[model samples]
Target chain A: AQRVTQPEKLLSVFKGAPVELKCNYSYSGSPELFWYVQYSRQRLQLLLRHISRESIKGFTADLNKGETSFHLKKPFAQEEDSAMYYCALSGINTGFQKLVFGTGTRLLVSP
Target chain B: EAGVAQSPRYKIIEKRQSVAFWCNPISGHATLYWYQQILGQGPKLLIQFQNNGVVDDSQLPKDRFSAERLKGVDSTLKIQPAKLEDSAVYLCASSRTDGLENEQYFGPGTRLTVT
Candidate 1:
């Protein structure tokens, strides 16, 4: 079975400080990974995907297959950046992209 | 374009009761999905629909949970004889079928509380 693991249940950081939310995965084949974010009272949205190699909202995640990790990082944290973060992988079940998500990490940036 | 829409943002029911949540996907989206999110956990895929057909329901507790996407546009998820463990948020999301990067759009979600 495939699984995603976000080791941090909560990460608290001061505003302007660097932030890193760790994510690891267990899968047998090459993986397609993504980071999703949910802000206060907002719907869950895609922050970035490893395949696109694009940065969104100053956040970036690099897929390290050797390490089996795709950690999300930002140079500086902002108050507005406090939200729930989820790491997901597209499962290879029947060719349809079924997302397998981690337990999630809540990031809180304080002033 | 309008995002996915879900109704009854919150619901409460007793154990052994029944409840349902509704969802309408974005226009022309060919794929729809349902997920369950516990209070402190990430959303888990409960079901997936492709144009009114079930692509996957492997995670759904079929004995107590059921869902239908009729007309391939609107969907409803039902939980009968609800359990306390079923308290969670039910989220609806949809994605287009054309591109390889099928980025999903999500709804506000229906929060269920079974006491």
Candidate 2:
């Protein structure tokens, strides 16, 4: 079974401070990992994916297979970055794409 | 393109009552999904449809929760005899299967409050 774990329920940080939202996963075979964000009054949207290896809005995450982790990081967090962040995993065995998401972390960036 | 669309942004009903939510995936997208998100938990896939055909529905509570996609375009999820525990956000999402990267686009979820 594929499972994504985000231990922190809430993460608070000051504007311009570095931010790291930890995410861990459990999957038998190679799985795709992703980070999705939901802003206030906005629908959920893809923030980044491990397969892409590209940063979005100054945020980046690396899929560490050995550690079974894909921690999202940024040197500095902006006030607008405050939102709910969810880590999701997609198992390759499932013929089609089906996501398993983790308990989200509410990020609060204070000015 | 217009993102996935869902109706009745909010719904409130008493336990045992029935409710239904609608979803219209992005044009040209072949896959549609329905998810249930509890207050403190992430969205859990309830069912998936591939062009009007049921693809995955392992987690869906078949006894009371039912969903369907008609003509391979729009979908609807109906929950009969709702329970208090069912009060949560019902999210609808869609993705294209043209490539290996199946990035899903989500709709502004419908918030259901079961009193």
Candidate 3:
């Protein structure tokens, strides 16, 4: 079974402050991790993936296999960065892509 | 490319009533998924389809929930005898294929309120 865990239900930060949204996972084999964001009145979209190792909108996440964690980090929080963040995991055993998502964290960036 | 599409942005019904939601995946995409997202929780996969064929539906409540993708392009999910607990956002998503890095694109979810 594959499970993603986002410990924070809500994370609040001031503008320009560094932000870190923690995410942890449980999977037996190698897993592919991803972060998806849902903005106000917008559909969920991919933010970043572990394999890509590329940052999007100043946000980056590194997969730590030993810790079973993939924490999203941003150098400076912006008001527009407030949204719901979800962490998901996928594996190849299913023969199809099935993402197991974690309970999202609502990020609130205050000015 | 156009993103995934779903109908009935919102739906309200009494318990025991039936409701259905539709979805149209991105053009050329071959896989579709139905997910149920309860308030304050993440989306949970209810079912998955691969080109009109049922691929995974282990978590779907077969007794009350059913879904189909007839032509491999569009899909529908039907919930018979709805329950209060069923009130949540139903999200439809699609991906080009089950490739190693194919990311799934989501549709603006249909919010269902079971009164």
- Highest DockQ among the candidates is held by which one? 3
DockQ, every prediction: 0.65, 0.69, 0.78
Flag regions of model 3 displaced more than 4 Å: none
For model 1, residues B46-70, the per-residue Cα lDDT tens digits are 9999999998899999999999999
Considering only N, C-alpha and C atoms within 3 Å, which residue pairs clash in candidate 2?
none
Local accuracy of candidate 2 as per-residue lDDT tens digits, B1-115? 8999999999999999999999999999998999999999999999988899988899999999999999999999999999999999999999986233888999999999999
- Note the chain A TM-score of all models in turn: 0.96, 0.97, 0.97
User: Lowest-scoring 10 consecutive residues by lDDT in candidate 1 chain B?
Assistant: B96-105
What would the TM-scores of all predictions be? 0.97, 0.97, 0.98
Model 3: C-alpha RMSD to truth? 0.9
Residue A51 CA displacement from its true place in model 2, Å: 0.7
Angstrom error of the Cα, residue B18, model 2: value is 1.2
